[model samples]
Target: MGCRQSKQKSKDSLAGAKKTGSIGNGGAAEAEFSVISAASKTCEKLGVSSKQIFGLRQSWKGIKRNMEDTGVEMFLRLFKSNSELKNMFHEFKDLTSEDDLRANEALENHATLVMTTLDDAITHIDNYDYVSEVLRKTGASHVRFEGFKSDNFLNIRDPFLEAVKITLGDRYTDNMESIYKVAITFILQTMVEGMEDALKNKAT
Candidate 1:
């Protein structure tokens, strides 16, 4: 009697799953997965083609880089474009401090860190399910900073591209820009998602 009851319950669960079109039993993987990333969903909604993602990935692999140098160049470009933007880094830090910044040991370390994170993110782009959590964590952490704004991500895009252009020189092209833009867009969207969630949790 006991064995018969257990078998009947299993059959019912499978039958219900088929009716709903889900194949597995309830669990965390499915739950986490069911929570579609803002980045992935936005890509679809914005009609960002798969070609963009693929093109971006392929082009970057061929591009050369002195990661630290490129990172430094990017920040330099960033500060130059909007010197006033540096004040956000402190309660009232002056533009001179931001402008005077150079590619020193600390900057080199930071540059390497940025390059490694992006390298890893790009490497795992094909399997977003694996990378989303880490990106989300990054987004949440950014929110904890003393003074940060979402626009900072958008604002950095131009500088980042400029850095790439300087690094790649003749190798840089419109297609490559498009690729970088796509990758950066995805990253920013994911980060915003995580940050928003973090904020929401704090509010509650």
Candidate 2:
């Protein structure tokens, strides 16, 4: 008798599961819907719509083709405006010339790493949980570097946009520029949050 009751309960559970799965689909069992993203919500608040997301991914394809050069350009722009930041990187900090900076293996590798992180963030733009965790970890990792401050992430803002503008050349328009601004701001903000999280965890 107990065995029969157990079998009946299992059947009921399967039936209930089927019913719950069909709740919002007009009684059709097709589970077609949108994936929710915390990151998307934050982006929306920052004026990045689905349309802009599509544009970012599209434009990024061009950037990815020349990742190394673009990454180097970004860092070059950064070093240009904030010359003092170069001291943080011992590998190429002593080099004052643009040609030397571009030729340095260390700077190239660092630029590649930064660009790769940006690529990941853009790739997973809709997935808030993933992007935030990645960015936060990135910030946390900087804790070990001497003179590294969370605000340093903010410094990427202008240089990054300029780098993109240079890379895109004729493709870069006023509207696209606006979208890129929103995208980078969102990326840097999360990174700062991650840095702060890391600092707190370290203290504890």
Candidate 3:
């Protein structure tokens, strides 16, 4: 019964996705559909649809446009949940204390930047190559950080998801989760791949 219900929910979300969006059309939609269709097929190994990623992107845009300080809240949750990890960040390293978020302009700005980057990428989610390239650069940039690992990204991704859940309130759906899981997984994988490539290049 639960399985059936989940499938039905997916069906509803995909159906609603078509109606909920007014942003893409003509060649844009076709292009996105092509890219998403291929990615979704690849994601079948992971049990998610590309359409779900599209729905996730749409739902996020809705929440973000209407919410205030969500990104800020997200970073707070991130730091709170992963206190040890926070120390790795330059902004939080000199905190004088583990809990000193006050007057942390860099933390605030960096958090906002991360959230805004996500927003920008979701807007062009179909631009997979471009998105992957940018994320790769982001991962490559982290090479200089001591003890940083690809898995550490979950410390960032999970809190961001929680913040989105909170902001969406009752509007959040399982469908979005399904889609977001795929998108997030793919993103982290690409970033890690980039990091690995950077390490290899530097070693050579």
Q: Which candidate comes out best when scored by TM-score? A: 2
In TM-score terms, candidate 1 sits at 0.65
The most accurate candidate by lDDT is 2
Cα RMSD of predicted structure 1: 11.4
Per-residue alpha-carbon lDDT of candidate 1 for residues 1-204, written as tens digits (9 for 90 to 100): 111122333455456667877765664334333333423543464355555555556566644356777777877777788776656644333435543566255655665676676667765564465567777777788777666765565666788788888887777788777767777677767777888888888899
Once fitted onto the true fold, the runs of candidate 3 whose alpha carbons sit more than 4 angstroms away are 1-50, 66-68, 94-103
TM-score ranking of the models: 2, 3, 1
Per-residue lDDT of model 3, residues 1-204, tens digit only: 111123433444455656767335464445445454544444354464555655665688765674446676677777777777777777566575434664577876776777766776565454566677888888888898999886776566777677777888777777776666666667767778888899899999
Report the CA-based lDDT of candidate 2 relative to the real structure: 0.78
Please give, for residues 1-204, the per-residue lDDT of candidate 2 as tens digits. Answer: 111122333454446657777445343222111233343454555666666666777888888888889899999999999999999898998998999999999999999999999999877675566777888889888889878899999999999998888889988888788888887998898889888888999999
Sort every candidate by lDDT, greatest first: 2, 3, 1
RMSD of 3: 8.0
Which residue pairs overlap in candidate 3's backbone? Answer: none
Q: Which of the two candidates, 2 or 3, achieves a greater lDDT against the reference?
A: 2
Q: Number of backbone collisions per candidate, in order?
A: 0, 0, 0
